[model samples]
Target chain A: MRNYQEILDTLIDVSKHPLRQVKEFKARTGHKAIGCFPEYVPSELVYAAGMFPVGLWGGSVENSRAKEYVPAFCCYVLMSDLEYGLNGTYKDIDAVIIPSLCDTLKCLGQNFKVAVPSIKHIQFTYPQMRKIEAGVTFLESEYGRVLAALEEICGTKVTDKAISEAINVFNDNRRALRRFVGLASEHTDVITPVIRHAVIKSGFFMEKPQHTALVNELCDALSALPVSKKGKRVLLTGIMADDDAMLNILTDNGLAIAVDDLAQETRQFRYDVPSEGGSAMHRLAMWWQIFEGCSLAYDPEKKRIDMILEDVDKYDAKGVIVCMMKFCDPEEYDYPLLKDALEKKGVPCLYMEIDQKAEAQAQTRIQAFSEIL
Target chain B: MYTIGIDIGSTACKAVALKDGKEIVGSSIIQTGTGTSGPGRVYEDVFKAAGLMPEGVSRIVVTGYGRLTFEKADNQISELSCHAKGVHFLMPQARTIIDIGGQDAKALKLSPAGTLTGFVMNDKCAAGTGRFLDVMAKILEVDVGELAELSSRSTERISISNVCTVFAESEVISQLAAGKKREDIAAGIHMSVANRVAGLARRVGIEPDVVLTGGVAQNLGVIRAMSEILEMNILPAPMPQLTGALGAAIFAYDEAIKLK
Candidate 1:
């Protein structure tokens, strides 16, 4: 049986190597890109629409471009938008979707339309969920608008049969993703580092069909592998841990992130409100109602904190990690209370504020925190 | 020698030129950017109006929200320290300071020698800031600059209860729909902001001789309503916004002399 440490070490070695040629090759194709900013971005829809869905990670912290557009108060949201708009790193993207999660992104959308005039802009204007029908109708209208926009840009109309088929494929990918998550919980001795990297990369690289097959195969293969040494599991809470380098550092430090409550993935996959027997618009609205369970769709401050606790216990996490983006007010307000409550429940909680760029300091801090656990 | 202070706040820039600890020139006014330009640009406007070159300015101090952002400063001081200094400079008997700026409101306590004793700051929301008043004025279809005069003329006192500016704007419209006089609503908005500021003061315990500063200090209605709520006579410095800048300039002077 392959040792888990050996597998992780090999993966780390691969991650550290130069990949300029690989990235240059990918960029050479002039990919039809669609960028999604954080938690609940429905990559499935983007894929079904025949556009490469790229997760906009923004840029590094030093001399950040985000500070120019957004106030010093909203650091994280500004950085992500700045990465695409100010720096022009995501120049390949034809269009982008920004959800009205909080004031930060709302302001970013309002400002960016004026700041960057080249790209198509769509804001998923969220509805108050107190009224079910009204909320669904609002969501359906938004999805229809997005779909219509995507069809125009991509030059391909999405038939109902096409959407239903795409949903099935995405559902399979979700099931496979779930299996991988389950394996991580079971203390797997060996994880397909290729698949782990591919699953995340697919959000950037391939269209839906190719990514689904690649990820599904990896999960099926990993599930068949035997169990290894079970390390302390940790549940990460807060904005999607944007620091890839930091994640690598933490994994290297023997802190296996068995589960994470990323704003992006958790918000996207957790809810599946089927398009009921009503009109296509009604079905789309139903999908949004289900997706709204993720905090990115709405301000689920109290609910999300409680949900984090639930996930921690359900995953049997040894500790909780709350990764905050500097200048993010809502998370900052929610964090202290969550930290105190988690600590009270005898859970070791570590809070770290990261800038847009994940630097060596973040890695060092995560390494240090992981050592404590 | 004049000790000049400048505060590049969120919404306005303030400048004060003090000679022998007596104010010689001072001004508090709107930022020319109208809301888009940075705090540094606002300070440039302040300096331009004062007709003072950056090099000619001696013992320069800076304070307030954009204090750190403006690098061309002799020294930077916290708004708390500057508020204390401004209050001490204006009214030597002042023991408390209440400030409402663009997006934040703070209440500070001062020792006899102008040392900061303690303070409470509301940095989270715009509930008690001048922005709240501006929003209320927009709903009333009046210029925000004229709000103080309009509010002061009201004989009937109406209550504006909503804390959130979005909700408060809606409430103000509803009050208008209900045939409430604009002056009554304007006065009520002042009372609401004053009530919030008073709550902030209550956190650190209101002290006597309270000095009010920041852009909102120019609003007579807010000062009058706050005075009534706290039951203390509020004293405002000649150029309230410049207190932070003056505080920053003072720190710069101290540093320069120490180096000498």
Candidate 2:
């Protein structure tokens, strides 16, 4: 128990101060580090290029400087990333890889390129028709483009075998993360929502292998405990739900997160990159093809709600709580429809806006939802 | 046994004491003060009015933005659920409830039994809330309480379309400089708030017997504008601001009965 607490506490500290982790990783490994934006990016390629891929999900920062480049209507995640770029917060990093997954991100790439000329910016647009063979071809081209940009920074040739090895390591990390999420739901008393988020989020900063090992140990420790009856079982959905304030509120209200469809968490790892394909680049592109039912990705039938219901039944959740990030239109567009679909089937739900800053009202919303359950 | 429910809102605090879970024996509304101590102040005021002390209450359920901060609350509920329940109790026919409070605007769908079936809330912006009305009233040099009457007297309607409170204030300043009439702009501000809230209500599918609760429901101008925009008669709760407190009181009564 002492050993597990030490390991989890260290990882949570790393999540709290990301720049410290970046400096430590650079000093410890003597390897170069680069930044990768959230939702989906070809981090495996960066790993193959002999550099750590630091995930940038934009922490709680009061930034008005980003408004000079982007509108206030843009999501805080994108705006905060832009703010970090302009404010020299990420100046120590070599380069940044921005994926044009949504409209805000698409525009962010251009703004970063024009505004921050010091850091090299690599941008790529994922194929919208990602379920077809041609989509596979398109993704391969995109990965190849990013790979070339990475090679220029690493000053090393990224061979197919290097990428293949990187894929195995990342696949291990993903599997371990999925395992921890499942284990944490049963032992929420030990793994609290904030700790669960920290353990998952710390994976973004650490090397893929070390992260998996720590989580794999945490999972082993938690597997021995009986199911915790500390909180109500509920599923979370939306862009990102790592807001510590909201997590604490859930803890106070006795709401245990049974599962989630958040872009920053399970949505990123719900599948793995197929190891066998034309090349490592093609396999990297294939991850996008297998992805579906996310607000960021295009799903013509809009089947996200059905997938959420599946989690609800699987986790035996009483209801769903959507931590809708403020100013995110893509997620906003889906809420009414998702609510209608869930309620028609007798599933209950609560909607609370997750802004960058915490407010008492958001806490009340969570408390009320839990009270009803 | 008497049960109590208290709601500490952003701008005001309201509480209700119920007898036998069906009658409102005592109720009080007061402006919110600083910190986690506001709910207790309103609770005392209500208890005195009800001719009962804290010992007489069997259960206490608190709801609203400041709910968790209330130290004496036995249970905490959400303003959305509370409003839905309060409206259902006030008007049984209400299937949809729209609440515009100090800093939020929400649309909640309720079953006939008053359970929250579906709902939606504005995303951290104050354009459609009571705070926006207060700011607009400040700009128009009229009391916030009187602007509702002034808005109703406008001869020609003006439109204020910005959905951000800060930007809307600037737009109002520009309109004032542009020689727009105060009554017209006041009417436009109410219409803008109405239009924004009406959008949220429609998304939740506004059914007949739509009830309005919270502080903004007291403004006749917003209710009139919403009635025009939604093309349905808007039913205001008897004491709109107290509905959340009343709902909490109902929950307290239910909890006490279950314990028995």
Candidate 3:
């Protein structure tokens, strides 16, 4: 019998039969599918609704077809979706939920609804300001409404118990995920490239049983592995940055991404306290705090300064790489403030902007930035 | 017999009525928006101040931030394209246009024949724009409008380094700490913005006869500083702030004729 680690490694090594594997998994499962972007996509809630939550990465840069449809200054999210839709990769999607995190995203959703007539799309206009009590109440209602709609579509009951169970599963999975990230930071030899790939795939894609198995294997493998060299651990700030190849770019230049303070990842997931115990809205309050807590969500330069310091110290990081997306006005506005804060605190940071069309310029800059780091 | 253009800026509305599209019949500048009221109310006040009837105008074009809010506009054009068109109309030989407004600034490069080639805008940051100068001027206890003339008269341009508005504000305080002359620092700030705008134009290749429009164009100091940086003559059109409205009016006239 294959070990859990071996199973994950096989799932990750998709060059041989990725489509066949995905098709097989889809065929066996009778789960409802929900598509979501990085921001405000609560996968745990989706799982509670008895639906499969697929984290949409938009599309690949190799597909030049997206360039013709969207302008150079438009958000990469729109272009990626267009590419994904036109390329027939998203044919199996039942519904896509978009968050109005920015003007570009708002416009992108409207246009996407028009372009893809077949898919059911819903836009959630999130409040820009997150701190006040009024904002949290608004968000809780919106979350409740979205869950109800999701239940109607999936034909499943999303009881508070189910939500609690889903949260526990996710919390367990997060522990496993943290172990993998820690393993990467430690540069353990046993956590091979293949295993890492398997870990990410299973962590992001798998629902319950498969997800648990994958996590267990990952944790076990990580526990057994010896720590490698102490390198410049970096926390990536700004934009949902998977597509820009920043990880490959950084790792190639002797920089290891120990963690990401992305709006999509750690920022959206709050510490789930029982909603009924003390305040009856503790979880909702925590959710709003999570958004406010994230440095990426707003122009909290001091918060970013503090978060960067915390991440750097925790990961033994040498510096930070602010990965800005082109035409991202908010990040651009905050970059200087963060830069000042970082500089004053004696932590070095570099600002690099990238679009979907990764070019030679990005490569050269990454090389230079790494040397400086 | 005359075409009218109205530019409802953040602080004021500048109206220019031109006879035969070349001669200025009446031009009036007034405080904009009437203390948070819409431009429509302010427009009525401006027309009354000019002693002109609403029907006396053959065609009207509105532009600026409040352009869309105006109900009587024949055509509404983007400030970027309008600034370019307005500059091109004034200085036909001009190849580059730089318009610095309250919230944003744009550097536009026009083809020899007055068509847009390329442009760069600073909408993300308050630095290197009119807003920066305004804040600095307030700190200096002077009107923002006067900084242009005062800076131009300075013997030399000083350096106000730092791109972030927050940092730049601190930088200004530091300059004060160092006992630097206020006029020289003001001149330096203009030079800094001019440098940024010039750099943007240089990316697309700057041409001769660079026209400066928008509210900042009224500042002769910045224009001179920009000219010094580009090593080219900086031409200011008559009623530069109204250029967007003028360009919009031109488009409106053309559209009306096409319909006829």
User: Who wins the lDDT comparison?
Assistant: 2
Which stretches in model 3 have alpha-carbon errors above 4 Å?
A1-11, A14-22, A61-71, A188-198, A243-246, A264-285, A292-302, B1-260
* Index of the highest-DockQ prediction: 2
TM-scores for all candidates?
A: 0.52, 0.91, 0.55
Error of 1 at A77 (Å): 4.9
Ranking 2 against 3 by DockQ, winner: 2
lDDT at residue A303 of model 2 (Cα atoms): 81
lDDT of 2 at B57: 87
Worst 10 residues of 2 chain B by lDDT: B31-40
> Over 4 Å off in model 1, which ranges?
A1-31, A43-45, A61-65, A187-198, A273-281, A292-294, A297-301, A358-368, B1-260
Predicted structure 1: lDDT: 0.65
TM-score, chain B, each candidate: 0.88, 0.97, 0.86
List, residue by residue over B1-260, the lDDT tens digit for candidate 1.
Answer: 45566676677766665554454554444563223454555456556666666666667766665655566666656666776766676678888888888777878767788876555566346899988988888889999889989987898989887468888888899999999989999999999999999998986557788888888888999999988998888887766766776665565555566766
Candidate 3 local lDDT, A1-373, one digit each (tens): 3454565555465323333444555678766677776466556677887777776656444546655656667767557776776676777777777777777777777766777767777667555566666676776667777777788778876887787677667667666566666666676234433334345544455565566666667567655656774445567777655542555555555666666565544443334433444232236334544544453365444576576677778877767777677777766777767777666776656556656654433443454345345
- Order candidates by DockQ, high to low: 2, 1, 3
lDDT tens per residue, model 3, B87-125: 777778988888777756767767787766455555357
* DockQ in order: 0.02, 0.55, 0.01
Off by over 4 Å in 2: A1-3, B31-41, B166-185
